[model samples]
Target: MIPIPRTLGLTPEQVDDLLTTADRAPSRHDNRPWRFHVTSRVIELYSVPERALPVADPDGREQRMACGAALFNLRLALHGHHVRPTVTFFPDRSRPGLLAVIRHGGTREPTPEQTRLLLAIPAQRFDRRPSGATAVPRNEQHGLRRAALDEGAWLHVVHDRPERALLRTLVLRAERLQTADPAFRAELATWSARSGGVPDCLPAGADGQESIEEEPLMALLTSHLTGTVAEIQVGQALQRVLLTATAAGLATTLLRQVVEVPHTREELRRLFSAARPPQAVLRIGWPGAGTPRHGGDVMTTATVP
Candidate 1:
């Protein structure tokens, strides 16, 4: 058996580079609820309880998913550095916050697929506009399904008219409810940067003054939601799907308005009874040529050795 590489072999600068790349993973509400512990050859991902968004992610499902996304990015970064990463999920149950432990292993050249994904990291943005173009080609859609399976999740596309109508209704209702509720509005305002005039929220320019039109084809992610554990797994899978989409040169935006409401949530679940439960509704498309408005940058903390 090969012995695990200890901390003595890896330098602080290399570990810092891994953590920095991992931090770039897209997260809900811009709440980066994760931490990193680097040894010589292993990097451990842990959850930061204080960073959890209680209102938006009460069960910490999104939080864990955010961390999982980071974990995935870490793997990619290692590949970029010409190192293969070996990862163990939930390495220690006694320490629930410890999400995964990744170690540098045998050398292998980054695959074309990995290189494509790495290059896409900066260009990918959440596209909320109606895809307008025809539904994704059947072959591409099948490819997406396989990507979801790679992460242990299922992606169901809403193709039928009745199901699409039902989803549209649920989303409209949820949007109304969320816009009406003071708490929800406040949260949105906070995240949207409307509150306190913070520069970090999605700028008015990003969404434009007009509402984003809904696309005919939408996708919902469902996973077993047995408890908080299942929710986290769903989140991880969600990140995988999003990253895979990015790699495929597609843009995605999440629509949580409908699923935020209890009634709409139930309606969504009913639409996909065979799956666990829908975690998010995603709209995918090719972003037309246009100047993207800046949405502000993510906050990060750095420690110098």
Candidate 2:
């Protein structure tokens, strides 16, 4: 077992509150594939394999990455409470499910950087419509790229029409293929809210045909394919881009339809040879004028074990 910090001041209830709020960070499919172990002073984030999406994410890459984003949020939540957390990732190889162990290192005022990121959390939503606005401002784009870099990932904006068109076509093809496949369609349909559905299945709002239709751009986030470690890094990078977008008062929605197809995956790899292999695609923009505020709650609360 990992040693716990000795000087924690927050009660177990407070820690639970922080963890619940932090885990509200967006994830693919609302999988919520995370377990928390809260001691007197530290919180450990572990992966819950049962929540993994085997069909779409066979290797559990997206699940782990989503947890990494939660870990980042946990750090931010601690900052909001005026505590500086010391974080360790993958602390024990024997326990591969352990994603992070965060301890209350000491007290410090929230830094300017932390404050900016925290301020952006609530405003960020996954906008699934064509942004009425033009291109994102250059400075904001630069900031987004930097955010990914800081998290050990790179962000490439496809500016040229040819590249963008290729990505768009690939996405459309993947969407068609997934819709056509009986098995894939069955899985998707099962997740939908029928007259009656499994409590653990995908929520109604999360499984609409229109979710992927609103965004056209197919921006990819890639990582080297040699090892699981790279995939985890890519997930963290994806989260950084997301939070940064939120901070800028922008909206983001990931397009998993393209990456779900093996053929399209290969095509995207061929298209973006210089960047790492594409792990996921995201479309970012300002929310539409009449877009409803309701996108469904992606948050859950649990006792720390």
Candidate 3:
């Protein structure tokens, strides 16, 4: 463990709390392919390739996206502690494993926006409705899109009836391919199936079902380019959008089934943007009365560097 220092007004207990919050970010097949190297002054995030789902995520886009989400939580936690964090994505060209280097800067009080967004972190859940779709207020939808832009990513809302129809067809086909693959289903089942009190995987009760109901505001998050660094930025944008939506009393779930397939992803790229690469698609709407928030953490794969 890295010795927790009193710098930046953060106590050891606060640092531990930050780590706990970051560990809850979602991942592919619940394989949290992220590790942290922390010190009093800095926190570094890295990807653990061993934890990746090669067949389902052959290009490792989801892997980097997972690390990006973790990085966002770390920054938010530090911000809440009144510590200014200087972040550099892909700071070291020589060390590709080091996705980000977040240095703790001077102490200052968090802004109202920061506080509200931070509060929404724990409420962001993988919501799945058995039937029917709920609608979100138009203003709230704009706020969610703004959150992504602030993080240097794009959220393309698919609303046209024709586009929604195309998306449904593409998602159904991709999901069929994934569900038919023995290895993919085996891996998903292994991580998602919980027997004890373990909470490292997807919610224990979730039946890994794709939503075939009427579409709500389906948005795709895209980056300027499709690369390792770009994917990390996309992840940060994704979390920001999801948290902002949750703060606005909306339930959000990632639509990975559509974007996981390479060919389908190409189709999405053409639909959303020919220039930018789509990293994730999110389903946004009003949740049921008292929908449960998602919360989980992974076993520490590596520690302080």
Task: Please tell me which predicted candidate would have the highest lDDT against the true structure.
Answer: 3
2 against 3, candidate with superior TM-score: 3
TM-score, cand. 3 vs. native: 0.84
| Cα misplacement distance, residue 166 of candidate 3 (Å) | 0.6
Name the lDDT value of residue 82 in candidate 3. Answer: 87
C-alpha local distance difference test of each model: 0.63, 0.65, 0.71
Residue-wise C-alpha lDDT for candidate 3, range 1-305, written one tens digit per residue:
55755444567788888888898776765567899877656788889978877877787888898899888888888889888888887888898788888876778889898898788776655555432255766888789889999998888888887777777777777777878899887766665563222332212123422443354677788887767888888888887887787677666666676778888888878875558657777766666445543332111111100
How many clashes would you count in candidate 3?
A: 0
Return the TM-score for candidate 1, rounded to 2 decimals: 0.79
User: Model 3: runs farther than 4 Å from truth?
Assistant: 1-9, 130-134, 194-213, 289-305
Ranking by lDDT: 3, 2, 1
**Which regions in candidate 2 have their CA more than 4 angstroms from the true location?**
1-7, 194-218, 224-226, 291-305
Kindly list the per-residue Cα lDDT of model 2 for residues 1-305, writing each as its tens digit.
Answer: 45433335776566766767677766654557878787655678899987766766677776777777777777787888899988777889999888878877889999887787776565554444455354667887888788878877777777666777677677777777877778766655554444134232111134323333333333566664436556666766777777777666665666676766788888888888844457777766555566543332221111010
Judged by TM-score, which candidate is best? 3
Q: How displaced is residue 249 in candidate 3, in Å?
A: 1.3
Of 1 and 3, the candidate ranking higher by TM-score: 3
Per candidate, the number of residue pairs that clash is 1, 0, 0
Candidate 3 Cα RMSD after full superposition onto the native fold (Å)? 5.5
